[model samples]
Target: MQQHLLRSTEENLTLKTLCRKFSNGALIIHENPVRQVGGKKNAPHLKTTAYHFDVLDVDWINTESSFEADFVLVTTLNPSVSAIYHQRATLTLSNGSTYTPDFLVIKNGRPTIVEVKPHKFTVKEPWSKLFEEALSICETVNVRFEVQTELQFRVGNLHKRAEYIAFCARLEFTSEDILLAIEEVSKYTDGMTFDFFMRITGLPKILILKLVASRHLYLNDALEYEDCSMIYSSPAY
Candidate 1:
């Protein structure tokens, strides 16, 4: 059997709970001060609300130099991820310095710390030191630590992931139609593409995309292609 790491102190306590507890108890949930360069914004700061099984409903993202928004989507779609919170956990170093991680994720009922940084900063002075400290702290708690960068999500065909998420948010999913669409689509052995399924069922494209977004329809390259062209399967059938 796979080993389970440290379970959370509370049965249903989430990382967001930790953030709230820290904020309420006056523990320094410290974050780097936002810096504006050249009197202009570096990049757009974006916030997205997750519709799936995440603990925190709203994810505030730093889209400037990091792909934090995409990471949020990735985590939301990941089955292993139970919950995710932004800038929620604080780790205090032996030197009396406190640092907040970019995300605190509950994966398979265990707490994991995720730090999202620019590739250029990964090997640099402060980030290197910070990551080391974060790793050590996580190790002490029997948790996993991960460092994320644009390389993970901004590759070719991956840039569209964030946009795809935005598009799916506009899609509609009526229960009866979605079920009928699934039942109709499952008749095909070769799997079904969104356009073909829509042509067959006369169902709207938005509802189809909604099923795909929820993973009720499974697609391997779902993130890489447009919704209409993507192929999918139903685990139910």
Candidate 2:
């Protein structure tokens, strides 16, 4: 009986390993972008801006518009967002029109196709119809579809803060600096103001912004960065 049980356990382990491999393969396949973003030389009409995201495997991701750029920045700061891709998928509508989404975001381990459009344009003709078709396609595939506007991305100077943080995050900083900042902030149970934290750490303002951008520290409810802004330690620590 003991010998039989050991053989069964070995077979189960092999099966589990194969299942894990299969799941990983499926995830990779799903994450692959259906269309590639073109550069200025290839597509003169489209304005491309390269954005950096540490969470994404690629060195840089390109955004076509300011709205898209803001979206990328804010999404990068979100702890729940694990991965992001630009122009990730192209879906065919029932009327034979193809629609390419602005972003493919992996948030909380689920895939969501997001379209960023101006508020005025969302209510207009062809765009409205196109969005409807895109929603249908996403629903069929069991993927989430969302339409984001400036209201969502530019909330109370959040985009401005995100952009500033992104720029500052590029500056040189060491792991020791980050650890020290976190340690100082963790000492305050209720958190502390940005100015107070800065005073205690003696780290440069840029490095503090870098910590916020990297999500090692968080901002106030509005996500604005200022002297009096409330700074909180990351719960992960």
Candidate 3:
């Protein structure tokens, strides 16, 4: 319901100021905000959704309603994200209750607090209140805040493209392997088909995919993985 300057161009962040913002305002429940002091269950099969990212060493996902959007945020969005933590920061509201956001993302040296809730639930009662507090707290630290839902996640074409890229990112490639693959690719001045490229490079499909993930290979405008006939070198290479 409320729109914030979600992404700011300001670089006025410091270790002291960042600490002070969290210290001054909202109480961050570090140990156990949930504080479940009940009986410890044994071997419970949690029904939470799990997502794995090739870029991240650990799997961080939500079993809750925001799983889909959260998955997209980690894998599909910008590749410049330096790190991601799930439920690592807690925000204690004015009412003495605390809320743990879905994710804390550090991208391009800036922090962003992200809340993933379905769009239909955004205008509802309690979530609206919590999100407002989240916005206020995030602004105090000069960190951007975002609320993502199905609308942003369900774009047909972009979602497919992102899925392909993310899958490629997970494929393992060593530095030496990448260099050798690129050197082979460098010979194709006029560009080459997906299959032909794979054949000449003599790399596994997964490793070839990693080339695309690392931007050594560029996708044609068609954006069709199956119909992707042409692959060119990224200018960055």
Candidate 4:
């Protein structure tokens, strides 16, 4: 993949520039935040965190709040998401104000401008109008716009499962183990329960959960992680 570096000196790069670079199949890199995250004057109420997803190929991705952190974690686990950039661009709104979206996500080769916020704030002034302008601008550039909130992240133990899988992914594992697990699951055709898979593979649960985290094994997003939870082999295998 081609790589295009956006240095801190180029923080004022336009959205159209980002779109064009992405259209040319270049990996976009912005190593700085467009706005302050959790400074005392900026967002004292929210906690800040940094995360790294190997698939994104970035050293660290920083987020201002736990909500944004969860968004990063959940999005990183998605099989379709190809890349994620935090505070990637600064856009000029129609009202002469500027806006910086929380994330720019590349999924299935399409660029999506994502804004993470609490559910209550989405309906409030300034934010509502700002999102409207952002959506309008995105439409002109042929990019999709999305608003993600706690409601979406907190659905049906999805966040809990994502957290568990991420933790397990950090534990020791190997390509051979992943391959062996996938080979075993591929035989089931209709998928199998988690407990049954563990019994058959003789691989520990951590390895199995690691597979789920890395998306080598698929699980129902709406279901809680349990012995009975169904697991399927990724089509890639």
Candidate 5:
């Protein structure tokens, strides 16, 4: 039998966080849980929010998952945990290695492949299959995935918006239903975009994809290479 023990207080949660842009244009702070996790190390900046989520254990987002608050602490990190990420390591893959995606996200009715990498080796690919999968998006748009920092993933707002929109539409909403959505979404349009949209919107993957595929909304240029990008349609001129 395997026994799980709590870490000692003196262990000191040390980690190196890297912020990378996702295919959806959201910045994510990434670190392996095996190496370290987020916590309080010292005094945090007045602007920092509390950290709530850990990497590695999260599942590949599926049909019933939420886009809201997947992670917490939008503004800043707790001081004590801030320096835990000081130890940085480079990723190395021998030739003929297999590349497995870290986490696959289904956004806007498609799969957005997300691969978390540290700051320095953000471009390193250990799996051979990844090279082709990463390159596969070169000609597509519906796919969204990339290396990112743990901090970026914490914002939780970018995916929120898209999720909200998707949720509203998934109800098979009519024009009348859109009115209710307007009331809800109107309160937070400051940082509205594809990434935030998916986060805050609380919508289903299919609805979000429909809106983008139809070009009713626009996404950041960074999303062009995402495999999920193909889900969006050409906008009506």
Candidate 6:
């Protein structure tokens, strides 16, 4: 989020608020985070994840649009065209390759072509819609785009992103909801490495890990490690 006007007061947000704030070009980030936010499959572990996810949302929903364009969309899909797109993946356009948009927003007005780009310089552009639409009034065509960071877009809405991730991780899980989300996310993902968890799990990983550490692993005197290198470090060889 940027240093701009304030709209939120003391009220908690609803789903519609989430939809509105994160609608098209909003950027969300997980403030302080950990690798296990999205992984680990214990009952106590998930509450931790949920908490952090909420924190990210607390930060995210407060994001502001940039004064200058960081990511630009020069669309020629025809203003007469109206459509909604369902997305499934984040993208980073390879050099000279075309950029794929993640989702489309059709409101009988000008288009935003919904995409979720990184708040950092990790990519040149966002990816395309993951699924196909059966609606005849719509067309799903990929396009090329460019990104030039005009300002540092805050990952404030990330807390909301975390919540959404945790929820999606557990849909149809049919168990202790939190743990189920954990189990689903952990096992469903293969070659589960810590760095991979960092990117995929996002913020809930921090919240989830904290819950696990304090409740299950840490509990008493705040079990602390100086660095993540300690995780795989052996006892002085």
When superposed on Cα atoms, how far off is each prediction in RMSD? Answer: 8.4, 10.2, 8.5, 5.8, 16.5, 20.5
Misplaced by over 4 Å in model 3 are 1-24, 27-46, 49-54, 57-77, 157-177, 183-208, 212-237
Give the winner by TM-score: 2 or 4.
Answer: 4
- Give lDDT: candidate 5, residue 156: 36
* TM-score of model 2 vs. true structure: 0.77
Residues 118-203, model 1: lDDT tens digits? 78999999889889878887786566789987777566646466457546755666778878977876777677677787677887
Predicted candidate 6 versus true structure: per-residue lDDT over 25-100, tens digit per residue: 3121111121222233443332220111222212222111221111111111112223222221123222323223
Better of 5 and 6 by lDDT: 5
TM, every model: 0.65, 0.77, 0.60, 0.82, 0.26, 0.19
Among the numbered candidates, top lDDT falls to 4
* lDDT, candidates in the order shown: 0.58, 0.70, 0.56, 0.72, 0.32, 0.28
Residue 21 shift from truth in candidate 5, angstroms: 26
Best by TM-score: 4
lDDT of 1 at 96: 78
**Candidate 3 lDDT, 1-237, residue by residue in tens:** 111111122322322234455554573422111322111154244234445444432344333333444444434234455445445467777788777776666666666777777788988888897898888877876768888775665444555665676677766678888887777767778776778866766766555556666556655543445524676666558
Q: Per-residue lDDT tens digits of candidate 2, residues 1-237?
A: 011111233323432332343243111122334444553255557656776566444445668778888888887888777666666566766766566678767677677789998889999998898888778767865778899998898988778878888888778878898888889888887988878877877877677788877778877646776788777888876
- Rank order (by lDDT, best first): 4, 2, 1, 3, 5, 6
Ranking by TM-score: 4, 2, 1, 3, 5, 6
TM-score of 1: 0.65
Summing lDDT over every window of 10 consecutive residues in candidate 3, give the lowest-scoring window.
1-10
RMSD of candidate 1 to the truth, in angstroms, is 8.4
Worst 10 residues of 5 by lDDT: 59-68
TM-score winner between 4 and 5, please give it: 4
